[model samples]
Target chain A: MTNQLSLQQRIQMAFPGLAAAYSVDGLLHYRVEKSRIPELTQFLHEKARGRLALLFAVDCRPLAEKYEIQYLFAFASDHPWVLLTIELAGQDRLFTSITPSVHAAQWYEREIRDLYGLIPQGHPDLRRLVRHEHWPKGTHPLQKAFPWNKTIGRQQADYRFRHIEGEGVFEVPVGPIHAGIIEPGHFRFSVAGEPIMQLEVRHFWKHRGIEKLFEQQTLSTAIALAERVSGDTTIGHSLAYCQAAETLLHIDVPRRARYLRSLFLELERLHNHLGDVGAICNDTAYALAHAHCSRMKELLLQLNDRLTGSRFLRGAMAIGGVTKDVSAIELSEIVALLDGIEKDFAELESIIFANASLTDRLETTGVLTERTGWDHGVVGVVGRASGIDQDVRRDRPFAAYDEVPVNISLYRYGDVRARLRVRMDEIHESIRLIREIRANIPQGPVAPAAAHRPQPGQWALSAVEGWRGEILYFVMTGEQGSIHRCKVRDPSFVNWPAIQWAVVGNILPDFPLINKSFNLSYAGNDL
Target chain B: MFRILKKSLKTGIVTGQHPHADQPAESPSQAVCEKAMPFRQSLTIREVDTGSCNACEMEMNALANPIYDIERFGVHIAASPRHADALVVTGPVTVNMERALKDVHKQTPDPKLVIALGDCAINCGVFKGSYAVTGPVDRHIPVDVRIPGCPPRPAEILKALEEIRRPASWK
Candidate 1:
């Protein structure tokens, strides 16, 4: 605690112009002039090595007569999260862009422009990110003035995609709609002969105005909305939202509930990772391995259905605690199911590893260099494969992760095989963690006594390590305990840009295989 | 490869008996079932996800796995819409996907059936009031069958497909 306090003092000493520097709700909140944001962010990234976890703007017109932009940073060594807040007067609508120094701020800045209409001066690519071309200009959806259900009638306009010209270069436009049962995303590849010269990606086609919908709902009903942000990540997103709400109200979750939360999270990781291993094999024409993997994945889903009514594990998380409690019988059933799955998975892996051609195809295809990964701040298995060894579960402990330590898998290859290896290892680790959690299951009430309503002008940031990577939720309370603003950042939002860098120099035909290896969520990224 | 063959021989026939057995006496009168006489039982399907969270798609993919192997029932997921007899769509149709969904429906050969899977495709499900969602699949195309669930179970999905493939008079 003293170290954290001195760290706050050091930051204040470093930046004398900061208006106030104090710890609020266990997080160091520093308020500075809007002009000092870029310089302070640069110092944090380069000198202090603080990773930018989230950056978003909040419309505070009614309460403060200003728009507040928050930058959340997480330190690796101490696992402390600090918030740098800049309150801009309603009259002044522009702020300096930090994308030049911190490359990960590119998409966040662009999103603020599209949703809040806040201008980021000198952004390298100032194009519409969340809203499409048909959306009316200057009608920012996240502003207080814009109604939640406002329908701006569509109009057709040309969206300019970057083009390359040469003697032999040609462009290949693939999908906002693909053939298979996958979500919609557009990819434009500039190719010369067999090699791709450059790849441009355009997503947010599935954007359903989720943040706007959150504003209209109360704290209790917002969990259902958060679960729908990405179907595959129901538990992950819902847990982060509940944690944020819990923090805002200063409620303490039961020890038993925290253990149950970790158990469900591992179950999600197991099923998803198993499916990915199979999908990657199927892409390489190995149908047998895929069939076996699918069997294993289905078994897990059945267990989840038995534990919770929904197969996707929805309706299990509530604010301050979990909704469903796991009985002794159900816990034993999970262990028995895991025993059978572990054996089958081992057999499947042996067969997969025995195949030389499959391994050959995955070894060196679609390499994303470690330098590129760091520059972009990629998360989850993708970053681990590229030698960026940071997992939110380990660095910033949440839920029962502090009790049950996580062993992060790392690979320096930065290829398809490396990513596959990371998933495989994580699957095993999750299995072990589940077993440990089941054994040490504590005895206590699952839910809190009563739901605590948050006071106005209070905010909290919560992070949960989803199957893909880190999921962040920033919640702010308005008058009468209503949610003023909620910002959800799925790991896909950060990793999707890395795919464009990964696909370069690779043949176009191998694009699908490389993409399945990443297996990013379109709905999560788009939202 | 020899070991693989030996294991296959030991496993014997893992395929289901759904196709060879007689159609159930209480078969429901669904679009697929109406056209599914004994002579014309085989079918092909093409799946599209408009804007789902991908949970429904996971269940759809599970239909091909060993447990509920729809291939045993003579149903195959076709690579192209041209060869597919039924189009299975999921999620609440997003504004951007409206054009693609209509184009896919147009490209499919005649005598095609549209099966709206999950609650989202049926009536926009959880995302009923978002600005980006155009609405349910039926709003754009005529849906022959609607399987409703947050995400329908694999067994439920199989039952619906089985119902669709029965004779029209069976109901």
Candidate 2:
């Protein structure tokens, strides 16, 4: 850790001519020239040894002449991200896309193309990833001066996916609706019989302009929106936003409140992972494991209701502090619950993993290699399974996470089984974490956010390792109390590509198990 | 066939209430949990998705499920705007959804109850200031209740709904 900090300091010292540092919380943000981004990122990717995860651009519409395309790059090197913003004016809005350089930047580049109307100079497969074709011309909503009222967030289907051509590679069109109770998303699967040739995920069913809405609401209220980005990962995303707000406002929640937030965050992980585990079992047609996991999850959910007055453990997290203080008694009950649940969960897991039939489908299926995993910039269990040891909790701790140690489980399988195992391991880790936090649960004022309002122009980036993955939030408020703009990037946005990749080499029937294993949030990404 | 006949012979009657063959059919808490929203007045609510993906819908569905039993709070969700009193909206009210959102609020009856359910609905929490969304529910509609979370748990939603009607219900 010391070597990393000093090495970064040396680099910053050397780069005084080309780049500078902006520290947000404990994470360092080094802004470099656009021309130097690839080199800098390559240095970080190679030297940082895969600490680098996602690279995406955001367009900042200033009153000035030039358009700003900012590149955000993070590393697993236990160092802060180096953000490089380049000014694109005239015809130069097109910079050479980084898709060729890093695989993960592929989707981010396409999204930048759609929202900011900037094309990556040489982006491969540069089609409309989102914003179906026929969006009214001369207006990119994210662009500054695009009148707020002029923007119409319409869900229009546009353009056909370019399919891979050849004999026996027939197209299998499914969804906008599926057999199960799932969200609206169309998947274009090209296959020869059961084996999938290629899968193109057509998202944007529930794409409401969440970012645009945040442009107008108060910080406290906007939190409600963040929490809803993905229901299951509410605290995951909420913790990110809340951390950003608290950091931006320079508000430090009470110690007890911080511990409380962490408690809910871990609890959120427990429930979601348990649910995912159960869902995967169901997909594999393992009724015994499926039923047992669901029952276990039900017990947890019911316990959550008794402990926090909510089944999904919502309303427990506020901006600076949590909404309600979890009592010592409840904490003890949670500990007991975790102990019992962990035993049940492990028993079911062992039985499933040991079973020959279950292992056959899960093993060697939906293989995403190390290169592909890094390239897609996948996060959470999916990323970990693919040998990307990027957990926001372990990498970048927020709230009371700094004090609480977390176990980041990593694997190299990059398949459905790896994903499932990562989730299972994470649940076990969550149980351990719950027990620890309960033992060390502090006492103090649980509410400290609304007490002191932050002065504007004091921007802060607070990130948390959410259950799904790393949830990143950037907050910029005006000199007054109002916010100018804030960007919420859930890991789902980056992980969706991995989902597409998972469909490769897998039978059509096995897609359910594969999808369940990853279970990327469509709504969270759409927002 | 003989095994089936033998199994049937163990039971006295064909129409016997069960897992409770040994005792009563219901647990004590089950009665109250099974009852519909325990209020005299039902809060007419409209569910709007400003920019959420649908995790909220999962919890929203669970509200009416036998377990959570959201109807026990006199909170029946209304489909159309004109028929609603409270707005139980999710998502950040992304740019494209701005118009429909405003219209929904306008069409709703007076003294409307608005709830910003889930993290997205309350603050556009993460999607803050993106180009597409225009809300946290409060931007387009007056939010009377706020259930914070990505998708507020059913219990949280019920609590938020309860908060909205509490003052009036007392009156």
Candidate 3:
């Protein structure tokens, strides 16, 4: 990670044609032309910099005028993020492509195309990534003028993937409707019954226009919007959004608030990771582990309810301070619960690990080579399992994480087992953090933030290493009242490609297990 | 087999009962429709994407998780304008979602309660004016309940729901 790219440096390096660094709070954003996105993405990917940050598009005709789409990129080696821009003309415009350089860009590019109709030419697979097949193609729902009654104008031509047509090469089209209640993603599996030759994913059942709605809106409102980017990653997304807002406003949360925020974020990871570990066991048909993990997760939820007053710890965070304060009785109760859950989780995980059948199923199942993982720039448990040693909390800390250290777990064998191990170990670490934060809970106003923050044109970013990985937020003020632009990048966006690589040789039954191994949020991606 | 027997004896009854001793949400058939809030009821909410990027919906569903157990409240998301109640909306209600919001509101069962939860819903929190969203839930829907916070906690959601249920006299 030597000679890392700072915000300005990264943007300069990635998009050399782009010039000038515009300071927004502490983060630097380079406002570059839209035409050079593909080249920039290629350059960044070549260096194995990091995952594609996020694609943000907004229609500002109502406010200050331009209808623009901004693309943000981050480097794991350093905290620098490049913000590239494209202003769509005539209220409707299209842009170039970047899928060729990064295969992971296939879905993201399609998503951008579907929402904004900014066609990413040269994208190998330009199929719908979020909207269902029935959705109108040219509508681009996220665009400003697209009417709500926007129906499918023309029946989207049947997606014609390069079908393998030989005696042995057969097609396996799995559902837009899957067996599990997993999000709607159509997988076109090219296989010899079980062995997958090539896999193509047609996504977009959950396309909800989030960016189009944020124009001329306040930063506070967007945080909740950000929270819903992914259900499991609420704390992470909120932390990122708040960090961006606070950075843009040049405000900081109290130490107590910061500690409390981290506590909830880590607790979120604890609960989710526990469910993942248990779910993997359930995948192996190990009944006890499922029941035990479910119970442990349940207990943790109860603790969240008692401490944060919300099972998922949503609304617990605020831009300046926390919404709810940790009470003494609640903290002690949570400590006890965490202790019990930790003990049980540890014992249950050991028992599951001890069982050779469970290990056999998980050991080599859904393996993602480190090279492929790095190439896609995967994050969280998915990347950790694959031995891609990059974590935002340790690399760049925000909120209470700055004070509390994280011991990131890693194993060279990037499989379900490694993911499970990361989940288990992270839980242990979270437990310790919960106890520590609770013990040192400071006394202060959990609510001290001002009514409204700085005037328009200020920009800032706050990065929090949410349960998934790093949740980064970029905020720009406009109208001296509302947000000009906001970008949300979930860990799932980074890990979705890695999951595709993992699914290559896996049995279709194991697809769910492998998919869960990298549980990317459909809502986050769709938005 | 003997060790299994010993362990079973050591750890009794891991399985139990209820809403019926098992899991409620797991099986759609088993869920008893206790006090159904059918779409025909007073408030008809039309969900508009209003370009939020989609974090609020994820949590909105989390309310129904077996743990938080929001189904017991008889609150559920509406599919289309035909069957709707106060649109419990999320995100910044992005511009892309604004038109959809308006049409949906137009389509709802009327006397709709617009409970705006999450920061994005209220004032476009993070994405204030991204040249995307036109404004908050109020700019589009006649918002009644404004639940603030970046993305209000699920408890906040429950609180907003309860608040919407209250009559103006109670306020």
Candidate 4:
């Protein structure tokens, strides 16, 4: 609380007459002049030392005659989020770009330009970020006037991919459709001999207009959409969305439900991390580790199905609390399952580390230095692997994280091996967390009987540290308590840009290994 | 190496029996069964993701894992569409991927089948009315079979493929 107060004082000292209101929701809203974005965000990012977590635009027209741009900076300390708001009149379509000063604002600026048609005046690369070539010009889907179901005619426009031209430099284009059973995105690699010189990823091939679709949904129905934001992080996204809804609706979740939410979040993490550990080994042609890991992952998914009705743990999270409660018998069953997997995982971990050949492929392969990680604002396991040493569960505790303190595993190597180690460590930690939650879990009603309607114009920002990274949701309630604008920042949005830097000097075949190490979500990023 | 060998030996064979080993084949699937008759013996599948949340892809990948190992039943995921006997597609066809979906469908040769792998692919489940959606897989291509579920379980998917692979037994 003192840290938050001092931070507010510092911000007030920096900007005279700014009147930065620090609300109970942990948001310090500074509604500033449009011209002050670059300086304000740079000051907060560098001086205040906050990670630029999310930047998005809300089309507040018809309700209000302006487009509100929100730049949310999350702190490594107990300090609250500094939300820098720049409202532009409906007629004014431009705001000064903060990308030149604060590098993390690059994609957010371009995305705002694409979705809301609010151009960032001085952005360096203003080429299309979200929209494809065929999307008709002047069709900003997020605007209030644009109906969600309206169809626009397609147009032809060529995309200009970054070119590296020289002798022995060859360009290889791969996938809007990959050979593997994964989501689609195009990768253009500029390679010479074996090592890649520059790699550009063209994505958003799976944009289902999810953000606009949120506007048409009530708060209850929106949880289903949130669960699908990234299927792998089903609990993570829905939990964040539900927390935001709970905050807006002023519904307090019961103690047992909060504990269950934490437990399930760890379960989701365990399965994904275990799968990646096996996948990274599989990329190196080590089939033994892959086979065991796949079996372990299958067992975990089956357990999830037995406990919750969904293998991926969808429909597990509700608005005020979790949908289902675990009985003593089910909890014992989970304990038994974890006990068996714990021994199996230990043996598997030994085998993986024991093999020098497997370790060689992982070490020094696809290194994303700590500096690069910070520059790109990478979050989650990828960021921790690169020595960021930040976890939202510890930094800003949510659910039952406050009661059961989180132990974060960090590495500085920032290589494929570093990423693998981080994941392995996290699996161990998740197992520990589940055991802790089961032992200390309080007995109570899972959810409240009814949730009161949120007032229009009320908004809340919720962040959950998903298995992949940090999943942030900025939700606002509109008239009739409908979702006004729900901006989802899947960790992939920030982390995807950093992959280009990671694969620079690496060989082409090692690309899959490095890519799998990160395992970013295309559906999440595209949405 | 000794540890791996020991572990492998101790674990022993884990491959399970086929979905229809104990009982007779259930009723033949819908109209798609006639179309599925050709690939009854062995089937090569090419999985395409139009715009799914990736749950379908997760289950599809699970089919290849040691537990399911659909390969024992002569079902394989081909590296290229050209080698595929059927295209197992997932997701509601997004506008961005509409052209690519058609191009992939066109590339598959004659007597090829298209299976819409999840609820989203069959009818754009939750994303039906969104402007960015072009529609389901059937809107773009003629779907031979539809596997229903937010993402169908690997066992359920195996049973469907088994029915497709052995349509005559069910008939």
Candidate 2 root-mean-square deviation in Å: 9.1
* TM-score of every candidate: 0.95, 0.77, 0.74, 0.97
Per residue, candidate 2 scores C-alpha lDDT tens digits across A1-527 of 67557656756664556545565434555655667766666665566544344444444444345666555667654555666667676556777776676776777788777767887877787777657554555456666567544545445555678688888789988755444446556788999988998998887656666666666677777776676667777777777787777766667789998888888888888877877887787788875565456556656777777776566666677777888887887888889888988876766666677678888888998888878777677777788899977777777666677898887788998888888888899899989988889888778899873555666545566567878888777776754555656677777887777788778878998887888787877787776
lDDT of each: 0.85, 0.69, 0.65, 0.89
- Expressed as tens digits, the lDDT of each residue in B1-171 for candidate 1 is 865565446445544422232333333445456544542667798998888878888888888888788888899988788888989999998877777889989988878889898889998877787777888999999888888788888878888787787657655
Candidate 1 residue runs with Cα over 4 Å from true position: A1-10, A24-26, B2-39
lDDT of 3 by residue, A442-467 (tens): 78877675755577666665567777
Each prediction's interface RMSD? 2.2, 6.9, 8.1, 1.4
**What is each candidate's DockQ, to 2 decimals?**
0.54, 0.17, 0.10, 0.72
Clashes of 4: 2
Query: Model 1, residue A437: what's the lDDT?
Result: 93
**TM-score of every candidate's chain A:** 0.97, 0.92, 0.89, 0.99
* Segments of candidate 3 deviating more than 4 angstroms: A1-19, A23-26, A33-41, A47-51, A58-71, A76-79, A85-96, A147-156, A451-453, B1-171
Chain B alone vs. reference chain B, TM-score for every model: 0.83, 0.70, 0.67, 0.89
Off by over 4 Å in 2: A9-16, A23-26, A50-66, A89-92, A149-157, A449-458, B1-52, B60-171
- Model 3 alpha-carbon miss at residue B30, Å: 18
Clashing pairs in 4: A380-A469, B40-B165
Q: What share of the true interface contacts does each candidate keep?
A: 0.62, 0.31, 0.12, 0.76
> Whole-model lDDT, candidate 1?
0.85
The top-ranked prediction according to lDDT is 4
